[model samples]
Each structure stands twice: as structure tokens, then as C-alpha cells.
Target: MLDLDDTLFHESDFARSGFAAVGAHLENRLGVSDFASHCERLLKAGSRGRIFDQALAECGHHPTPDLIEELVDIYRSHKPSIQLPRDTVAFLEHVAGLPTALISDGPARMQRNKVVSLGLDKLIDKIVLTGEWPDGYGKPHPRAYGEVMQWSGRIGSDHVYIADNGSKDFIAPRALGWKTVQILRPGRVHDGVAPTAEHEAEFRIASLDEISLRRVLAGSR
Candidate 1:
């Protein structure tokens, strides 16, 4: 299994595309020519929380509730120009024919937009999402792992999860006995951070290129 964000494509790339979409949306509707500065501010803030409100206030707009909702919808649903990194593409191909699944955390729409943009649905065998699961169980929640188990019909040693954010991504999978590996790509936002012992993966690697050394999945050795 895989985590979608930094594990495949960098979230920062998505953020840049979304910010440009936001800038274009603002320019088309609100006559703002210099939204790039506001975009930079939100990037520094990270997570893009309340970014529409921030940009609107900067533009002297009152940020009415309806307007904020509209802009937020635009930002989250934007079809981003992003793709799996080259090495990631090669790694996925190498793992082809495995019962590979994608288990990720995010709102259904936002994450699905990414999958669609990257054509990941064509690559992954199955997908599990917090929002799509019962009671909306995100990562670090065992139920999320359970969903992957159900979808792929694999358990414990039969499953392998490769994710980037060790802080939360490995917790449930490790607890559920799924082999876990962490891939910290260079230039990624979460690069250099160590996972807590509670979340530490069995193997920690710098990039997909290192994955060949760790391939213990059923006869792939």
C-alpha cells in the first residue's frame, strides 16, 4: 500500500498549483492583480488554512461567509498539475502485479482530485480513504488499516505499506502488523524529521531508489 501525498507527489507541488489556481480565481472574479504576495504569505503559514479569508482581507474584501466558501471550494477542487516523481513511477512499475493498495488520509474530494490528476487510479489496485470509510477514520486510526485489509483481502505479513510521514502514517499499519517503510524524498516538506518510536517504520529510506534493498514482499526478492 502507499500514502498519496508526499509518498507519491509532493504536497508542496499541490500547494503551488492550488495557490496559482487561487490567484487566477481571484484575478478573474475580484480584479486582484498582485495576489502572488498573498499566496506567498499563505505558503509560509502552511496548510492553506483560512487562506481565502486572508487573501480577501488583503484585497479589502470583507470575506463574507458565502464568498469564503466559494473560494475554499475552488482551492480544494482545483485540478492540479502534478505527477508522481520519476523514481516513484519506476518504483510503482517494479511493484506491478502486486495487490498494491493506496491508503491515505484527507477529505475525499481533495485527495481524489490528486489521484485523478496523477492518474493513480490506473496504477493502484485499490484505495482506502478516511472520509470514504465508516465514521471517517483517518490514519493512526486502526480502522483505516482495516479498510485496506478488507479491500485488498490481505492481512499482517501479506501487506506492506510505504508512506512518507512517519509521524502518523506508520502508527496504525505497524500496530496492525503490516510491514511499514518510510520514504523521505529529498526536497520534500517533511524531510529530515524522525518518526516517533510509536510511529517508526521498520525501514527508513531516503528515496524510492533505495526501495530495491528492502523489497521483502512475497518472492519479489
Candidate 2:
């Protein structure tokens, strides 16, 4: 199985995509420059309205209800510009015969947009947007893991999960005895901290460029 977000692609890219469009939209609406700076601040602070309000304030513009609504709509629904990397393509090709699954956490519409945008649906055999689950059974919850196991009709040693964000990604899979791998990539959303020993993956790789069948099998065992 695989995780989306930082594992398959730079999640920051999605934020950037949204921010780029939002910046441009704001510039056009407010006659402003330096929208990129505002975008950076918004990303750092990590909220929509408060960041939007702050950005407008910093830019010496007044926030209007209509404008905020429009920006939110655009940010949520934009055709995201994202791509599968060459190394990830190679890794997928290398595992052509294996049944692959994708488990990601996010709002269903947003995460579905990402999957479609990146063509991940074509590359993966199964996908579960755990955020769409009842009560949001996402990472660290065993529900999503259980659903994937049901699809594959396998459990325990039969499963291997590759994901990033060790903080939450590995916990449920670890509890289920599914071999887990951590893919260390640049610009992870949750950076700097490592997973706790109980939640940490059994193996780690820098990227798909380093993945090998041998390493995969070894980690699962």
C-alpha cells in the first residue's frame, strides 16, 4: 500500500498551486503586487480566513465577504497542477505485477482532485480516502488499514505499507503488523520530527529511486 501527500508528491506543491491561483486572483481583484509573500505567510500560518484576513491587512487591502468567498471557492476547487515524478514512475513500472493500494488522509473532494490530477488512480490498484470514512478514520486509525486488508483479502505479514509522515502514517499499520516503510523526501509537510519507536517504520528510503524488490521484501519480512 502507499500514502499520498508527501509520499507520492510534495504536498507543498498542492498548497503552492492553490496559493498561486489565489495570489493571482487576489492581485487581479485587489490590484496588488507581492502576492507571493502573502501566499508564503498563509502557508506558514496554515488557516484560510485568518491568513486571508492577515494577507489583506498586510497588503493594505480591506477584506470583503464576497472576495473571501470567491478565493475560498477557487482554492478548494482549482484544477491542481501536480505531476508524478520520474523516480515514482520507474518504481511503479518496476512493481507492475504487484497489486498496489493508496491510502490517504484529506477531504474527499480535495484528495480525489489530487489523485486525478496526478494520475495516481491509474498507477494504483486500490485507493481509500480515509478522510471520507465515517468519523474520519484516517491515519493512526485502524479502520482504513482494515478496509485495505479486506480489499486485498490479506493481513499481517501479507501486507506492506509505504508512506511518509511517520507521525501518523505508520501507527495503524504497525499495530496491524503490516510492514511499513518511510520514504524520506524533500519538503515534507510534517518535517523535522521522527515517528516514535512504536510508530516508526521498519525501513526507510530516500525516494522511489532507491526502491528495490529485495528491500521491499526484506522490510515486509
**How does each model score on TM-score?**
0.85, 0.86
Residue-wise C-alpha lDDT for candidate 2, range 80-114, written one tens digit per residue: 99888788888888888898899988778889999
The ten-residue window of minimal lDDT in model 2 covers 212-221
Clashes of each: 0, 0
Any residue pairs clashing in model 2, and if so which?
Answer: none
Those runs of model 1 whose alpha carbons end farther than 4 Å from true positions after fitting are 44-48, 58-64, 134-136, 190-195, 213-221
Using lDDT, give the best candidate's number: 2
| CA lDDT of every candidate | 0.78, 0.80
lDDT of candidate 1 at residue 71, scale 0 to 100: 72
What lDDT tens digits, residue by residue, belong to model 1 across residues 1-221?
A: 88888888888888778878877887898887666567666666663467667777887878899977877788788898897888889988888887788888777888899998999899988877776666537777788778778877766778888888867888788788878788887656665354578787878777777875346454243
TM-score of 1: 0.85
The deviation in Å at residue 114 for candidate 1 is 0.8
